[model samples]
Target: MSATELAGTAPAEANRIGAIETRGIEPVPADERTGGPRQLFWVWFAANISILGLPLGATLVALRGMNIWQALLVAALGSFGSFALVGLISVAGKWGGAPSMTLSRAVFGPRGNHGPTVVSWLSRVGWETVNTTTAAYALLALISIIFGVGANSVLTVISLLVFVALTLVVSGLGHATLVWIQQWATYLFGALNILVGAFLITKVNWDAVAHAPAAPVSVVVAGIGVIAAGTGIGWANAGADMARYQHRHVPGRRIVAAASVGAGVPLFLLIGLGGLLSAGDGSLASASDPVSAIQVMLPSWMAVPYLLAAFGGLLLSNNLSVYSAGLTMITLGVRARRVVAVGLDIVLTLAGGIYFMLIAGDFYGPFITFISLLAVPITAWVAVFLADMLFRRHYDPRGLMDTGATSVYWYRGGFRWSAVLPWVAGIVVGLLFTTASTSATDVWFSGPLADSWMGSNGLGWVVAFVVAGGLYLLFGATTARRLGGTSSPDPTTRPGARTDGEPAAVRP
Candidate 1:
């Protein structure tokens, strides 16, 4: 087939459908892959980081205090490129039959995979915490607006618990459940935001929006990095994992692109606008509380609809939070049925969710910090995985399966010590930078390097990528020459090979 023909027709989407038509084993069923580009778009749309705005916006507001335009610019910069990274990751699902976590085996090694997977698990758990906390806050705000009780009242606790329980119940169903929830939530929230935002625009002063202060470059850069990291990490790790199931009739790359934009951009705008609106007025304190902001934005007549819509969005957020948690658990080699794995995820997620809801005071800082910290290793793994595929031709041609678990990755118990050193160095540098920026005057370095490491994790990601790649090449070269001498075959140019079902082990 011509490359374009090969790229377009019988593309990644077709490979997935063929597997399903032939009754192949996969985590999510083929019927679940039924969405067209539009559906994929909405899925992406709903996936955009919604509550993230409250925390992220709050940080900027506290630091440099950006106004609406400035906030939007930061969001745009951070949010746009994220989807592309995710789209690249989604290629694995389409080409290889693995889920996001499963794909880690290639770069992380079978035994080494546990590090990335654990990092992924923690990241998802942190997300669950943020969702639960946001839901709790939103519910309390709504209850006060509707019935006049205080936000921290006993009644609010009961309401939050009930919602958490419900989230847990629904989260147990896996992909089928997630897709359905994604559709309904996106429609409900999208409509509500439009309706309320329109009313608010008419009622409120547009001058205030224009008068808002511009965000500082440093703050804007940090904000963008935070948003980009939040939006892209999982998607980058698993976009293909979800996209792989697209029906043969669906266009592959288009679905990926649509899904990315749908999920990342809308959420960015939604949260960014919320911050803008809240900041202009004294409601800045409740910037994270979408329902309250919604009610304030609209007239009494529109309150019910806005609340209903916001509630749906909240549910949708929890659904994804819990669903992705299920994905991480399933990546474990324990081999439970898909349904069972999801059930486990729901239970575990609920416990963690509730704990965070009750205890986490400043949910935003920890939410961003935990995920950003965990992302370091996963990003390293991804950088290495892509490099291996591009230059080393690691996969067997006939099956397209990455059978390098033994020859390529099996070095040092499948954990490259070389890669480990770089990872440690990156973390240490990133952490030191973070500490120096936050406490340089007290802890010494307060000048150039402090700013250099001001938003240390952001720089850490790039450092980790370069360091890991360099270490992999250095080690891979020596190992390659010693094991087989001369040269190693390229993966992309060769015919595919079948798998022996020996997925890279993820020993933690």
Candidate 2:
């Protein structure tokens, strides 16, 4: 089928303006895959150009004790390097034309994929909730600056509702709409951010930034780990979700470049600026309300635009997350339309936002703890998924959608222990070196090796990735090749065969 025929065959509402996407967990037809790599650039760039990076940078200086120069280097390395992995994994989406978790059916069997899918869903929901809370704070700050009304429970609820509603509108519209919004929004909000950023630079105390002592190499390494976990590692699982729309012919290198450069450039600038701001005033790192904290540094005249840009940025990020979370929900066996899944995810986000905004005692404390704990499993999954990607280039689309016993991915009763064992072992090893805390004095979970160099340096996620990928390559490589090889039974005759007449791949 040609592009025109494929588009005509699709439901009119699919990817149409103001229409909820109807597709769920199935491979998008190759003829319908119209997007290219450049679109991915905007998608990732816009998703990441949020004000959240500022606080991440603040943490590096205020909590981790790094100077501006060291912070910049860490920001560059962590943001670019981790996202490069994200881009690499995205290539699987192009090959399979399915969401990330759906593609994983080939590596871990249908049932076995659940563990990583659940973790990915939780991570997306957590991040969306945090984005909602932060965006709400920005809206509240805007109201206070414009109308002189102080924040109260009523305003808090209203603000959260507004952000969540906006997220639903964009994310619920699904792929085409998100791709369009991310591109234009990146232009509009990206420019506004630069304007606000320039104004912010003038406020920096260069003397303080320049004179601050450089952090020791160990802390620098730790800062890199912190930045990587906070920025790219958190985004790794969702990488291929957006890439499912891209044409399979697009070079894998282009996909990787798009994600790395697009996200890396802005992150480095934003994080470095954050370090500069913190160098002058330590308040940003410890600020109870980050929106208000950053607002204090700007002149009253610049407050409105700054807050608007901040809100817009967070909305962009949240939309992508909510969209991915919805896909993840379907991958987790939620029987509903994609839009319906998005609505369910938003309900959880609203509840989490209310707790963090109105009931929680501290923000950064809990925020850091959330990142620390979730990063381990997410990284472990990424490692195993990327490892699987090495040997399995073409995904058997029918096998991916078919969860029954006849499915090629039904290795040993719906589970592939080769992948499952490495993933579980990775998480276990990671947690041993992991330490999570809600505050300096309020420790959440501290492993036996928490005080060791890897633990102390916040490299548990790194250790997890290495262990999982290495172990998979060592023990699971042959299994992966055998399972993904052309010897598998033909899927075209299967019950779940592609009705669209797309050719089947030999391996998944």
- TM-score top scorer: 2
* Candidate 1 global TM-score: 0.75
All candidates' lDDT scores? 0.55, 0.85
- Which candidate leads in lDDT? 2
Off by over 4 Å in 1: 1-39, 58-62, 65-67, 143-158, 165-170, 202-205, 212-219, 247-252, 278-303, 389-412, 416-425, 435-459, 469-508
TM-score of 2: 0.92
The candidate 1 region of ten consecutive residues with least summed lDDT is 16-25
Q: Which pairs clash in the backbone of model 2?
A: none
Q: Write the per-residue lDDT of candidate 2 for residues 354-402, one digit (tens) a residue.
A: 9999999887778888999999999999999988776566777667777
lDDT of 2: 0.85
Q: Candidate 2: lDDT of 322?
A: 97
TM-score of each predicted structure versus truth: 0.75, 0.92
Measured over all alpha carbons after superposition, the RMSD of each candidate to the real structure, in angstroms, is 7.5, 4.4
lDDT of 1 by residue, 195-258 (tens): 7656655654467766777765766777776666666754565565456556545655676577
